[model samples]
Target: MTTSNRCVCPDCDWVVDVPVTTTEVFKCPRCGHRLGGGAPVSERHTLALALAALILALVSLWLPFVGYSASGVSQTMSLLDTSAELLHFHERLLAILVLFTVWVVPVLYLLAICWIFTRLLGSGPVGPVTLYFIRTVVQLRVWMMADVFLLGALVSLIKISGLAAVELASGFYTFIAFVVLQLWVANNVSRYQLWHRLPHQQAPQSEAGRAAHNQGLSGCVCCQAPNSPQHKKCWRCGETLSLTRWRGWRLTLALLIAAALLLVPAHVLPVMETTSFGRTQPNTIIGGVLELWQGGDAPIAIIVFVASLVIPVAKILTLLVLLYVAERGNDSTVKNRVVLYKVTDWIGRWSMIDIFVVAVLVALVRSGQLMSVYPGNAALAFALTVILTMLAAMTFDTRRFFMPTTK
Candidate 1:
């Protein structure tokens, strides 16, 4: 019930009091974004989970990942081979993307969480270093895609099982455990609790239960703490606060245009080339989907279609509509628009599933003469399309949904 429990919603800029002591889930009254409030997990417990996940991630890297046997020839792929093979074919950017999303980002995120929570469990004040790590955790959370990569791995295994004997290896189980623990740690580590534990300076006098911008305050994008307009850095987390509001929509528009332009090449060109019995076949995204469908793997084909085709195009179109709405100063469907933006941001990362599938196939199905999978031009183009659309969604400021468009 402390009066300092005031916060500005990052999504819609709604100001409300979210007591650190509350046990019920809190949502922004204006836009339905989760604002805080839940049964809090202990800092020590979160630290332990993070440490366990880190160990599993390391183990997964060292062990053999999967084994494939076909036509009396066999191959075993280590976890790193997914990216290493991509690099062997000169797909450096895609390789780096696969490596970071599946392994590096998750490990770094767990490390940051362990550091922050370990400090919180100690008897000392949370220092600047811990604060910085907390900021890192927030930013890295979205980019940690071990779970998506896991699904992609499963899909790759399914696609290849008919062609060969596929065996799950020790690293696969270890990675599954790591992904589960990492998700648990992510879910239980409450950002509100972390920010609450940090010491806060006296906030400038402003009424709670109103829009923060109306009172000459801006919400910290990193920590959601309301800051006075004059401050360039957040008082709580030291994140830079943007003074301008319109730049976000402009940047979002530019990125969307780039992504839209890339979609044509992504769909038209071959994503991966398959060679079997000395004959080569090239497949585009849609062509692959049709192949999977005709091959009786309709479920996976639908997944690939939705993730690779429908989602990206839908996201771009939806974002374009949102930009139009923001430009026209429409506020009637503001809540709906905010919800759409959230969904767009959340699902954008899943589009990379196809890219991961290609990486896995390229690495695992390397039997020369009998069969082989090679990275194609469309793989990079499609990857870039997904990335650009994701960036566009991130650049889009949801607060624009609530703000008035100026002439």
Candidate 2:
């Protein structure tokens, strides 16, 4: 059989015929995935956007998402305040996760992008490490997770709609804009070009290495070292590093179904209970938002509604649709599947907004039990639902949507 002389561009998905002459450099015709081209950024642009993303991230951490008022009690929470609260309430895990996802990771990623852009603006090729850094930034781009927080916030708002008095804060809008800029920058930066410009180091040749490489069977994708080609396990790490797609569908499906079952009680049970003077009222998500609205914080009501209710459910539904399409091998659903995949991927992290809001309130809204905030069990369940469903959705294979229709 003749060799199938074609290669696929990992970045842009462009397919090109490999030239018969090995001397000719094969490049992607669409993205020009060769070497020696700088990204479309000037030093000034890189510095400016970096500064903006940094500023926005910092500002978001210190501003109030919404103000809470009940029975003549009132307060506000900033992002950092919430993180501190999470640590205080023994929810340190979620708080740390929030801090890194919302505060630290985005800032670091943007900084890395800026550093690379500033160094390579008009200069030539960068070093291999820097190129690795660029690839890392690209890897991290989708996982930054602002949208997930947003969705969670919306879901929480909708759930709280009927109960509490809530009002929007300046920080809420700032956070939204922060998510937008991150997405804009990530989408605009071409990874293919970025990787092409970075220095490429060929694997060092050795007698044994050459013999293993020439045998052309199995190895690590990262180090290009050969392994047990016969046994389907890497000799070095005992890892199955062959080109095998993950095969955990039964397990993933079981966990997801379990989470889906828990989602019922998570939403049905009370998430928060408030007491004032001698009166006590248990609040579901719907009740809280209505209380906030009736208390004359209409904007906050809307913010809470959108961030906590609408977005989370939307994200969940999006994920469900994608999973269904993928599992069924529905080629006709490919476009919709892709759209849902993008949506779920982009917004998975924003679900943390409710977690942040709760965390901050639990930390800062303390008044010696006279007026205090604490997370209820349902809050934990709800948070878990959002997190688990998002993860399940992510583990779903979208490429299945593109497979040939066999059934």
Candidate 3:
């Protein structure tokens, strides 16, 4: 329903007229405020586009992103081919990560989105099972990360502009489609609405259910508690907690620490050492940036340095500060704490700017021995560190950052 300079309350079906400037916020007249009363995503076209995206993604895997030729040898490379090349160069760890992030994970995420859209299309109120599916979709939204891969390709291209050449392939087009579909889905889907429609059941006063409830285990998103072992909602709050697939911050923290340690060596060591005839040169991230700067590419150098060096360090420090304050119960400055949380949350993924630059360089600079560019082990490790730490920060519950004022 189109509002004439007004916002409608989805809960009460009350249409409240608003001043033109207030169109940005959807405030209700009767109930005051509601978080998400946005448009529904039941459009037939979204589903069609989503399906098309999945097909394109599959085609991209088989087709090459671009073709390269050097020294009388020429070949086309798919996304998987790049990973294979990395593996061939004995960068086994990088190969595995690229395979997962670029080839496997995106595929799975798209497939899952397609399945969710299909289930939702046939629907009245989606059952508890579908509710779980919606949750999974939201969770996958955080980790899908195709844009980062695209960015890495872009970065790689700029690094070796003076050497070699690149030609676009069918796969690049498909990858672009994949990114568009993801953004579309994110805009249209309403997680709150999907879960809210499911029926609620109170938890039994029994000892087992009550104990589990107290321990934050019994209730989940879809079903009301006091119902059964399979009950979805809490007997108390009725707020949907993830019943089975709850994310663990502890494991995420460990992974981030391990990934960070690995990143130190990944950046310090040359990702790919180029050997032309008898001349050889190894390029670390710093070396690459310095070379770009000296060659009059100051803008690119600044961007790369900020993404590669400064952003990661800032993220690490921000997270450390948040964790420290939360642990110490420092409530003296609530506003500053909130500001830090917002900043940390927003900037966490900008680290992928370097990844984008890397991918572009790899695609553009494919001259084999004369000017070949390959993501060294450090690039892979550094990428993983960013991924892991971002995951850690997301799961770390910033609600804990704001110290409790009341005793």
Top candidate (TM-score): 1
The order of the candidates by lDDT, greatest first, is 1, 3, 2
CA deviation > 4 Å runs, candidate 1: 1-4, 243-247, 327-332, 404-407
Error of 2 at 384 (Å): 2.3
Q: Write the per-residue lDDT of candidate 1 for residues 1-407, one digit (tens) a residue.
A: 25336788888787777777778888887778887888989877888889999999999997989999998989889889999999999999999999999999999999999898788888899888998999999989988999999998988898888899999999999999999999999888889877887776667666777788888887888778888988888888888787335348778899999999999999999999999988999989899888889989999999999999899999999999988886455666777788788898899999998998899899888645599999999999998998899888878878777777311
What TM-score, over all chains together, does every model reach? 0.95, 0.64, 0.74
Q: Each model's C-alpha lDDT?
A: 0.86, 0.57, 0.58
lDDT of 3 at 101: 63
Candidate scoring better on TM-score of 1 and 2: 1
Give candidate 3's whole-model lDDT: 0.58
Candidate 3 wrong stretches, greater than 4 Å: 1-35, 68-75, 124-129, 203-260, 327-336, 353-369
**C-alpha RMSD between model 3 and the true structure:** 7.5
The residue-level lDDT of candidate 3 at 61 comes to 74
TM match of model 2 to true structure: 0.64
Predicted candidate 2 versus true structure: per-residue lDDT over 214-279, tens digit per residue: 344333332223344455653322335553244234444654776677667666776665554546
Q: Candidate 3: lDDT of 321?
A: 68
Q: Per-residue lDDT tens digits of candidate 3, residues 1-407? A: 22222222322223334333222444443434333456555647767877777787788777778665555556566776666666665667666666666657666666666776677667676555555555566566655656777766655555554544556688888888877776676666655444444443333433321123333233232322232345545443343545333334465457557756867986888755665665777878888889889988888788778878787777777776666675455555644665675677667676766654544445334445455666665677677777877776665544343224322
Clashes of each: 0, 47, 28
